[model samples]
Target: MNIAILMMQKNENELLKKWITYHSYLVGSSNLFIFDNGSTNNQVIEQLTNFENKEVNVLWDFNKKSDYEQRGSIFCDKIKSLDKEDFYDFYMVIDCDEFLGTVDEEGNICFDPLSLEYSLLNYQSNNELLMIDSQYYNSSISPFWFNKQPYRKCFFKKNTIAKLDQGFHHGQVTTSDKEIRTNLVHIHFHNKPYEIAKTHAKEKLTGRVSNFNLDYLKNYNGKGFHLVRFFLQTEEEYIQNQVTLNHIKSMSLYHKLKQLNLDWPFSSTINETREKLGLTDDDDSFEKVLPKFRGSIDYIAFEGEYLKIRGWGLVNYSRPIRYIFLQLTNRSRFRFEIIERVIREDVNEMLNVRGGALGFSARLKRSDLEDLTDVTASTAIVTFLNSECAYFKFDMQKKHKEFNYFSPNNLAG
Candidate 1:
């Protein structure tokens, strides 16, 4: 059966080459189709010439057509315009980073998921769609890292044609028959290093740049992540220890695909993907900012239900602070949570933040605050965040103990 893949692109040159290389191995280089969304770098379009696909659609300013609710219809119309001779048994559109195939434990990409399915191998069926499962991938090069979340990419059918639903996040496919599930996995490159992400963030998605919230942008934490103990580690040291985290539920199917030897460019694509991790060679692309720890922060106030934190290091939101460095304790009990604040906001030019404080606040319920206090004394916490680049203070001692930070010689200590 013939297979074809479709994808949209904007300022996606950061990992564009590697993405194409991986896809080339999945479907032949010839079956890959791309729609250019006014790529300023022109990298996506430039690389397209390397392979011969059925069609290449370029609409430089197709913003209105790319609306969340209108994309399905726009893409369906384009698919119909393609030459009938080049018809495909299955078609699925995805982003540059999404791999609609499987990868092994050794960090290697394998064959298509369908070829390994036992039910499909014996079936002579049509009019059914496969809702491919996807796992989010974070590149060491990406800036903001969060807890992993799983999502689906597209819908594929055996015989009858179907169009992808409008929303990219939704896996629904519109057809005469309802959607049916299939055992397929796709990998999506959810995060890229901060430097590269910033380069494309403005134009990468709908309203990502044009509609950026200036008030919120200044306080944005777009830095790489690492534990505090590793803060002093050099950039080179971290590179040697980077890892590939997988969030998929099944690996049996992935491993079996590896030995099948269904023939495509596996080694070359895997190598290309691996080599692009740190992106260190390009000085301008990946900035290795030395982690600045050992800095002092202040516990500005213990407002009703919020613990206010401020200081020089926290003021500079340009740098990435991985986790929310916070700790609250009482006697032997303690509470600590990663500081991924829902409204990670900072002060805007209009003084939007309360008292124009240039930092973040960890809102605590009154009962939670009482956990750290007593009639005669209170508990204190000294923790570091930004993946451990900066520090914050949370002290509520009645007969307070000596604070090293408050000493005469330890202003920046």
Candidate 2:
């Protein structure tokens, strides 16, 4: 094989056609070999087979059991194999969205059109191994931090004698220098929507296996990168700082589409996928759903049968007559049985608290403890008069990695 392109995808369809078409135009589709792992949709495989390049092989059931992260590492090891006997001159493994290219002496694209073959030829003079840059682009394509693509795709060399390390970003051999000098950058356009991006962030922050880098927060630009901030900040805070949302809400979708770059059709893809997913009515604006509920239910505990609820005053409402009410309910049926009212007189003392948090508990009767179990695990909810709430689960706090906490001084109003 001269140059073989390897790709693995799951549950992806929208961009698979474009990726195959563009790359096939660059370096003959005969060199393309896609490995589909458990794609629930048949159209994804059907489209790949529908291409004119019938010689392009589609391994549909290839390693369906393994996950993306494991498959990535596997591809690194088996970088070469043709007809079960031949070896290739070089191997190219990339995601569905990544496109490769080369640059000239002054850091300008060398060719009129993108050709992986041309890029490889042009990058020969630069270095022994091409250091493909990790450049990201947003779907919206605003001229600010979202649209500007990185300029460091160093067209790496194809070492004829030895193999190199391989992964999503950087792959090198143990004996090789493993130096990354960006000669020509590979374009990685992130087409994931805000909703999907949140899931990806949660995976990075909490999942057992992840592709996220520890220092990604400091390296990537903040405007469009919320995956990093998802762990560092609250969802409410993340939405407030998002640039693409701000841009979309300010302008019409038709207006933004007019500015879409043909080479990067992410904006158009976003619109199409957004409609297909039936997410036209989705709301990401934190300000729209942020509750005006004055304070937070800081803590909740149970002493045998007695329920102890601690809370804080959120605001300094000069009116002293209005009191705080604690509504208690059983988790089994979630029916409110006890309503204890506490005086809203802790605002003055809460000012000295760390977060202006105060302590308030509701009364409990032996009859109220009928459904509450001591052996198996029991839970109860404490609502703050439609303002705020907290749940008290027996010993569940230790199991949870993240918990919501609040300060009384931080009023929603």
Candidate 3:
């Protein structure tokens, strides 16, 4: 199948090589098409020219402004022209920051786009448009250490009508009467460094007119990006750093609506128009929910029936407390034990005991803690604690009822 991978990029010189390598690995070297929107760097130009010789098409549109809406329209026109000329059978429109791939039924990597497309096409969907989710990452640091969510809408099919709508971020398809197949994957770039994230947020929040009510912009004020960036940072840093929670809370709904833009109002109106949709009052408290273990504590512990003890102190005097606490009047049992203290290079010798076990250690700063939440191990612990805590609480109530019904003294009598 003849396929075209289209992308628009700016100031991505360092990332071009990796992008080329990854796409080449997925769909060979010749199928890629890149639209450079006024790159000032000569090195990036040289790199693109070099890749052009290897069957990659590089079009430098220095005349075009870097506004996402205009660029998207231009891109759509280009795709239409290519389609008219019969240049490609299927076109894949992706961003410079996105990675497209698939996980098979067995969760194996299917890097080949054609194969991935075929698999998606054959896969039956209840809905028409197939929307693949985006996985965001920090390319400058560790790529694997990232977050995956349904960030973007990437469509696929062998048809002339398919086109990407205008806008720099989250641009939807403008045409109607088309079925959407939500099956492809578009890994977006969401959590970059602070400055870059702020710039992006400002552009997205202020530049584009909110498809939602214009009033939505009044509360946004470009602070949601800061909160999201803080969220992506380590949890410890988030806690320690004096972020204005009230500011975040006040702007959250507006910020989210701004981020979602026209899509939000469009969906809400559709729902409201079709039926009597009840609007729930907002009860989200961003500040009050922040994690409390910001400073050094005796030990870090997550407990349940199966206790895991870690930390230098666990091997010593305390012998790590392992007990199931029953709510005084409830039959349910709460089980817990101390987990190991995490050791790091930044920790001091006085805190490190048991050959660096029982040492004064800094708990993960809020930023680090946020980062840890993304880790599978950390998430697993959190999940277990949540489930076990709920179960134990329920069990205690049942036990209390049983004890009250058949007291030990009554049984003895």
Residue range 1-413, candidate 2, lDDT tens digits:
26677787765565677677666655668778787776766897578668634677677656444445466556654453342445455566676766655433222232223444555555444434455533434443231222223323322234422343224544544335545444344545463555555564554344432445656554665323445655465433433354333121112222222333223344564566556544454343212221222344445544444444444333212111123322233333333333443544455443321211133444343345454344422332323322223322212233221221121121221
lDDT of 1 at 69: 39
lDDT of 3 by residue, 38-126 (tens): 77678888888899899888877543444444666676677777777775655677777666766332112235656665865563332
What are the lDDT scores of the predictions, listed in order?
A: 0.42, 0.44, 0.42
lDDT tens per residue, model 1, 145-190: 2112335455454334445565444443344455444434455554
Best by lDDT: 2
Which candidate do you rate higher for lDDT, 2 or 3? Answer: 2
In candidate 2, position 141 carries an lDDT of 26
**Candidate 1 versus the native: TM-score?**
0.45
The TM-scores of all predictions, comma-separated, are 0.45, 0.46, 0.47
> Which candidate, 1 or 3, has the higher TM-score?
3
Kindly report which residue stretches of model 3 are placed more than 4 angstroms away from their true locations once superposed. 106-110, 113-117, 120-128, 134-141, 167-181, 195-413
